[model samples]
Target: MLKLAVCVSGGGTNLQAIMDAIDNGTITNARIEVVISNNKNAYALERAKKHGIQSVCISPKDYESREAFNQNFLAKLDSYQVDLVVLAGFLVVIPEAMIKSYRNRIINIHPSLIPSFCGTGYYGLKVHEGVLNRGVKVTGATVHFVDEGTDTGPIILQKAVEVKQDDTPEVLQRRVMEQAEWIIMPKAIDLIANGRVTVSDGHVRIHE
Candidate 1:
């Protein structure tokens, strides 16, 4: 079975979707080994508790330095023996060492379709706001392997959501989550767990 360590920040709607998908058998041959968050009070931890899944809180503030926090986080993940690290809504920038260790084993769900409102300073509702400001009729979510650079990994799956004529960032964000993010994130995990996904030279291929 593919063991997963889901990392999140803030509320965990995406994390909930992943749990739901696993429970519903949409994502087979895998189970969540842990839910981790930088924010202690993140609702994702509570959700994990309710599901009897182990949860941990590792904040940079609690450690002496960023390097210390990164080391601890990597150690924790190694202790769990996780096969995949899922970044559901994780707000923290992944450490370089962790990225090197995990490599393409780490995956992330971005709010935007990427290459649009991604990279530095674009996250959460800010991505939706950028899409709205750009007047784009179509916006979506992307699941990709986590590389050293932000959102510059091999894309796995993307599902587009339509932008409404009179939609605020909050409304658009919600719509995108429902129509895109929630769907593709779990789907990507399912694909990876089944050994259908492969990365070659910074590109992804899905086996038939």
Candidate 2:
């Protein structure tokens, strides 16, 4: 089985999606080994507890430096022998050490079609807001390998959602999560777990 460790900072809707997919057999041959959060009060921890999964909180404040915090965070993953690291609403920028350690093993789901309403200062509701401001006819989600830069990784899968005429950021966020993020995230994980995902020339090629 593929052991996954999910990191989160707030509500864990995406984390819950993965858990549900695993439970329903949509994401096969995978298990969530642990859920880690930088915020001690994150609801993601509660979700993990409810499902009898191991959970940990390692706040950045507890460590002396960013590197120290990264080390401790990674140590927890190592303890679980995590094969995949899923960033589900994790707000912190991943440190370089973790990126080097995991390489293409880490993945994140961005709220908007990346390279559009993405990069620094583009997260959460901000991404939807950008889409609304730009009046894009369609906005969606992108699942990609986690690289050093913001949302600049090789794309794994993407699904587009229609941008409604009277949509607010909150409404658009919900729609994207329901129609795209939740759907593609589990599909991508399943593909990776089944050994169907391959990266070459900075691109992802999936074999079915």
Candidate 3:
């Protein structure tokens, strides 16, 4: 089984999708071993507890320095011996050490089809805001292997959602999450768990 460590910062809707998929067999050969959050009060922790999964909070504010936080966070992850790390709306910039340790084993679900309304300053509702401002006809979500650069990883899966003329950022965000993020995130996990995903030349190639 692919042991997963799901990290989240706020509402864990994506995490919930993964859990549901696992329960319903949409995703096989993987199990969430732990859910970690930088925010102590994150509802994601609550979700983990309710599901009887091990949950931990390692906020940077609780530690003396950023390095201290990073060390403790990495230590916590090490304790789980998880095979994959899933960033489900985790807002924290992953520590370089963790990235180096996990490498392509880590993956993330971005709010938008990356390279558009992505990168710094474009997270959560901001991504939808950008999409609305640009009046783009299409917006979507991306699940990608996590790299050192922000959203600059090999794309694993992407599903496009149409942008409506009357959509607001909040509404568009919800639609994207429902149509794209929720659908693709779990699909990506299943693909990876079954060894169908491969990275080459900094791009992803999937096997049927």
Model 2: lowest-lDDT 10 consecutive positions: 69-78
Per-residue lDDT over 154-180 for candidate 3, one digit per residue giving the tens place of the 0 to 100 score: 999999999999998989999999999
Residues 5-122 of candidate 2 have per-residue lDDT tens digits of: 9999998999999999999999999999999999999998999999999999989899999888888877777788889999999999898888999999999999988889999999
Off by over 4 Å in 1: none
- lDDT (CA) for every model shown? 0.94, 0.94, 0.94
Indicate the residue-level lDDT of 91 in model 2.
95
lDDT of 3: 0.94
lDDT digits (tens) for residues 31-59 of candidate 1: 99999999999998999999999999999
Question: How high is each candidate's TM-score?
Answer: 0.99, 0.98, 0.99
Q: List the residue pairs that clash in candidate 3.
A: none
